[model samples]
Target: MTRLVDVVVVGGGQAGLAAGYHLRRRGLDFVVLDAGAEPGGSWRHMWDSLHLFSPAEHSSLPGRLMPAQPGRTYPDAGHVVEYLTDYGKRYALPVQHGTRVDAVHRDGDRLLVETDSGTWRARAVISATGTWSRPFLPAVPGRDVFTGRQLHTVDYRRPADFAGLGSVIVVGGGNSGAQIAADLALEGDVDVRWVTRRPPRFLPDDIDGRALFDVATARRRALDAGRGDTGGVASLGDIVAVSPVRAARDAGLLKASPMAVRVDRHGVVRADGTRAEADAIIWCTGFRPALSHLAPLRLRGTRGRIATEGTRAVDEPRLHLLGYGDWTGPASATLIGVGRPARNAVREIAALWARS
Candidate 1:
């Protein structure tokens, strides 16, 4: 028999849990379907040495503050995992773990969520499947011909995996690329090269995710007011000078080169015709939204995103997207940012249900 719910949250990560929290407050019957074997969402898959760009107090969900970890300025990945697990348990959020949703489509007025476990018919569906599952790699010439090890940020777990390698090339300009390059440089023997399409933007030493979020929030407010642009505002893409990154910069290892023109059997070949022999290459090239499950709905817009006003889809009124990125809501991918959009989406869903 197909289970029916007022809402089905597709993902059990921070965003999904946040949606569940508000849905419960609205007294809606809902279930969160998570593909992971356990809780914590993408935090569980981050590299071991990863740290939050913001402090614990700044990184939290809707109802509870993430308990601060002693002696750490920024909580590590493990701390985040523990906090998320506790958050779900604390609210008794109904989550179906290890359930992979394959597709979502409309069955008349209700939406049908087809999963590996079974089918779910819901009055509304919130797709919070964030980007971790969709790591992106640029199409570099001869990439397939290169025989050395190649890994995207999603596959990277630790620098030790590349220990003893002669030379390694870390690609991308974002925080992931900077952090991974720094971690590999700590090994002290492997020749590490950082490559980016453009120069990396390093925020001031004192600036972190908290400050960046504030700047983004302000920019959003200005845009809402019909202001033309907020050019001076900082972006979440700007790298926060966390300790390790600072150390790398101090050691002069944070310097970046332009992206390579191609990859050969030996290593990366730059536009200048210099080939850096590399034993391995780690691509921190970022991720795309994990929205493949919504293919049956054909709701994709520009850049493979579901066009939405706030969190509600423009084409499909009952559909909402959360935690994907700013397109959904400002800073919505962050722990603290997810709450606002989740609340807004759930409120809208509740109102629609009431009218129905």
Candidate 2:
């Protein structure tokens, strides 16, 4: 039997949950399917000491307000998960957890979405699966030759996991890399080494008038203007341009080289003439979207991402991708910035449903 709905939202994180809530509010029927056993995607996989750089007030979903707090700093990973769980209950969102979507394809006018659990027939599909679906690790020559343990930042959860490891190298200069180095330095006895590109320009936790809000608003407009795609020109004004480098430097976590040429049992060879040896290498490189289940959908784009605009599906009107790059705007991939895009997506979906 093909279970029918006005829309089917894939991924039960903040973006997925937000989209589902808005669709419901617009008097539409939709179901949210999440890969994790619970809500909150990266929040569930984030490190123990991880905290959102954005303040809670600005990080709240569309309708719900985050719990009041004294500190203006961003909420920690646990706080984020708790907030999302509350958001789901408050809205009574119909989210099906532990339902990993296996494939998504078009069945003529409708979309056929199959999961490990069951198949659903939806007029629209929201791909809120997120950009961090799979952790990306660059392939370096002789990488497997390294004697020490190697892992991506996604697999890392606690500092205790690295205890007894004498020395560790944290690769990448982004927030994850900087935070991981700091965590290991403070929590364990291991000496921390950072392999990164340029140092990030770290802004204050709160920049001009709540930086998160400012960034989100700017990104929303950019998305609406259809300038949020991957290939779109980089208009630095639209994204949060703050650098995390100063923070990394203050923490003594900055490395000289950005590019990794190769790896061997000895150490990592730098693009310049240098080598770094360590007992473990934690690659904090970004993630690539896992669209294996989307093979049946026949998405054609420069990258694997499915591109769409203003509710009219790219190739198939019935197949709408919710969380794909710039689906709402340039920064739709972020936790705090995702709400507006999610809201926009649901409204677009509702309009489509109404016309049918």
Candidate 3:
């Protein structure tokens, strides 16, 4: 017999868990279907040393507070995982771990979700998978010909992974690139090169005590323009965007521009006729929207990412999307930033369910 649920949420991370918990609080019937063996999807896979950029106070899920530490900065990835696990236990949120959802299909006013475990039917769905489902790799010529190891920021576990490498080239100007470069530089005489197609912009942390307000203004502008694309607010990308060149220069990681680039499996040739060599290349260029698992739901877009008008649900109206990169105008893509949009989605879903 196919089990029925009011709403079947995919991806049991902070976003999914928040939606599920909120639904439960409202006495709504729902089930959270997660892909990981436990909660905290990417947090589980994140680099060991990675910590939340947001304060712990802002990082907690619905109805629960993160373990408090007065005047603390942020919690590490492991701490995030622990908090999520405890949240499930505390609320008894119905989440099936290790249950990888393959496809979600609409079966006449209901959604039939296929998974590795079993099939579930639900009247609605909340996709809380978030943006990091897949890492985006850029196509650089002769990329495979390089004899050295290459990795995406996603696969980067620790600086120890690159410990012995004498020289390293970190691609992209995102926070990941900057932090990795900084750490590598700190680890003895390791040569780190940061390659960014264009120079990144910078904003100082302490500028008349209005740094926070400046960022808030930018977000508000994005929201007003209807492009609530999060992920660049304080992310590795945003941090680097503020002044990557300066940061890299100060760390001795900056290099001359390659005006004309040609890869011969050894080095990058500049358009101004200069060659720079690298041992390893780390591409933090960014990621493409991952919707392979949702192949069945033929959404109206080039990628499976459904383009929305305001916050309206696409593809299937009953099936709502939360954290579908750029779907939530201007709030940023982090869990803390995604809360309001998720709540808004919940309210809209509730209204739709009530009408149904």
Please give, for residues 55-107, the per-residue lDDT of candidate 1 as tens digits.
99999998899999898989999999999999999999999999999999999
Task: For model 2, state the Cα shift of residue 354 in Å.
Answer: 3.3
lDDT of 1 at 154: 90
Superposed by TM-score, candidate 2 places the C-alpha of residue 13 at a distance from the truth, in angstroms, of 0.5
| Stretches > 4 Å off in candidate 2 | 69-72, 204-209, 219-248, 251-258, 310-312, 324-327
* lDDT against the true structure, each candidate: 0.91, 0.72, 0.68
The candidate scoring highest on TM-score is 1
**How far does residue 340 in candidate 2 sit from its true spot (Å)?**
2.0
Question: Per-residue lDDT for 84 in model 1?
Answer: 98
At residue 239, give the lDDT of candidate 3. 52
Superposed by TM-score, candidate 3 places the C-alpha of residue 63 at a distance from the truth, in angstroms, of: 2.5
Work out how many backbone clashes candidate 2 has.
4
Instruction: Please report the TM-score between candidate 3 and the true structure.
Output: 0.85
Tell me the spans in candidate 3 whose CA falls farther than 4 Å from its real position. Answer: 69-72, 207-237, 240-262, 310-312
